[model samples]
Target: MGKFAKWLGAGVGFTLGGPIGAILGYTLGSFVDGFSIQDFTQEQEEYKQQTQQRTRVHATSGDFEISLLILASVVIKADGKVDRRELDYVRMHFVKMYGKDRANHAFKLFSGIIKRQISTRQVCMQIRQHMTHSSRLQLIHFLFGIAKADGNVSSSEEQEIHKIASYFYINDYDYTSIKAMFYNESDSAYKILEITKNVTDDEVKKAYRKMAKKYHPDRVQSVGEEHLVGAKEKFQKIQSAYEKIKDERGMS
Candidate 1:
């Protein structure tokens, strides 16, 4: 069978019945012709959940895949123009996380997703509803990876990412911490640990432990084995930052 045959027709279809699915159907059918962002979502329960502020957990790998694709679309358009390097980064990362065939299907859907005007808040809230906080944090990290794929993350791109983080309910510390990973700077280590330069050595150690557990791959293990690879990369970054801080502070 071809990749398109498996599009939204594979990987357990966790989001195949939700607004994510509806959006996918709409994207395939509409492809931006008289597209009403509200057309498929107005009466959906997801919109209701967004208003009622309820938590609906049990997100599958498929749902995570859909959410990642949509948010990546948002970030890619953040700078008002698409960069081929950024586009390739999305393709390569997806292929790395998922196998080649699955990644190809997702990339095809992503090609369509990029053409439409998606409601960033609505899609994010849908993900926030279904996914655990840990999974959502992983989403934020993946998005930062997308924005930084093309050398530097522009100011507009940064702003769009910050907006998406807010929609996901990720606080500034977590956001800046992930941001620190891509763009290394003087205080990137401290930022990665979510600590301040003026903090005491003990506080730095405490922050390191906290961040280590928070970013541990096991925390996001529920997403899937593929995602754990990304999670481990994040965990290693936290470790590397802690080591750097320890080296500079002479803390044994």
Candidate 2:
């Protein structure tokens, strides 16, 4: 069987339901032989408890993988065309997740999606409906990294990302915090910590502690190793933000 077909067949053994199922059904219906929602749901329910505890849910799961590719494709085309840098960045992540061969296949799929007009708002709404808040935050963070891969985030890309964050129901504070990681801004350090200069030293420390826990690489166990690696960048940003605050305050 072809790579896409193999991926779909393997996914059939998993609990692939809800919006994710709908999207995948539409995207891969032609390639996936004998695809049945009823059968998949029944099997999924049978193995629900066993899989629930061990399922890595996002990025690793078949549905999540497709969702990531769809969103990533949209982000890649946001600036009007795909840049080699952006493509390489995404390819590297996929390679790490699914090996070179599968990554190539997935990239082909992504490239095909990029060629078409994607209803990004609709996709984000579906993702938000099925994914957890943390998972959605990670998705936005991944998109930001891709935008910065070409050394600068275009105005159009930034606008699209902001729209995505809004659709994900990410609050202004969290959105700005994630943006500060990729974009250079005057109050980036404060924003990364999700705080303001008006806050006291103790509050700064508290914010740092909270952000540190939130963005820690260990928090992304549901995804693959590459994602944990990606989380490290966010974690580092939080650490750097705290250090900057400490230095400015002359606190040892």
Candidate 3:
């Protein structure tokens, strides 16, 4: 948890209150061994001071990681049983994204999290209040990735992820667009661009440009460079979708 400690102050900002705070405090305080109960989240006081100085700021990398753990727990158990593949997907992604040691700390906390009861809506409310739109979209993408890890996304898992997307205030078009990335629906390309297959070639081109900018990795740069890789994946999906649409319509 040394790296977790290093990011303690940086990651604890707006997430230190309400559900996110209570849940994290409990996980670290009661379950995680390295932390102290007296002041489990030592950065609580620091978080308050920083909040007073700013408003609705972007979530730091540490904050994003914590949020990911909470939502991941909710999604993993949504189907009534935890699939090893889904768990492995999350763990491997974290290891790939943050390396071995930090991912280990995350899994330790994640283990405790999955063992608890989470008020999904309330937890999401706290996240929506503090996290940026782009970051929230990334969360949706990650949750879908998790849901599909076991080969197919179950109905229950898709419903839970859809609820999270709604709680995050993601519009239906955007949610479908992200959802389309992992599925092979007939109009997947159109959905990825937030457009309909019936649209004219010109409208398709316009939607492509709009979505390209919207999903650009730079939109969530404040979340930190570790996330750019994931963001780039989402961005590339948009690019691929456009290419598919262009080929279908025989556009130049």
TM-score of each candidate structure, all chains considered together: 0.86, 0.80, 0.92
Cα lDDT of model 3 by residue, 125-230, tens digit: 9889878899999999999999999999999999999999998999998899999999998899988998887889999989988998999999888888889878
Let me know the TM-score candidate 2 reaches against the reference structure: 0.80
Q: Candidate 2: where are CA atoms >4 Å away?
A: 8-60
lDDT of 1 by residue, 32-139 (tens): 454344643543445455445534446778778888998899899989999999999999988999989889888888998898788888777777776888998898
Using TM-score, rank the candidates from best to worst: 3, 1, 2
lDDT of 2 by residue, 68-161 (tens): 7878888888878879999899999878767798787777667655665667777787677656677678888889888999999889998888
Q: What are the per-model C-alpha RMSD values against the true structure?
A: 4.7, 4.5, 2.0
How accurate locally, in lDDT, is each candidate? 0.81, 0.74, 0.86
Better of 2 and 3 by lDDT: 3
Best by lDDT: 3
Pairs of colliding residues, candidate 2: none
Q: Tell me the deviation in Å of residue 193 in model 1.
A: 0.6
On TM-score, who's better, 1 or 2? 1
True-structure Cα RMSD, model 3: 2.0
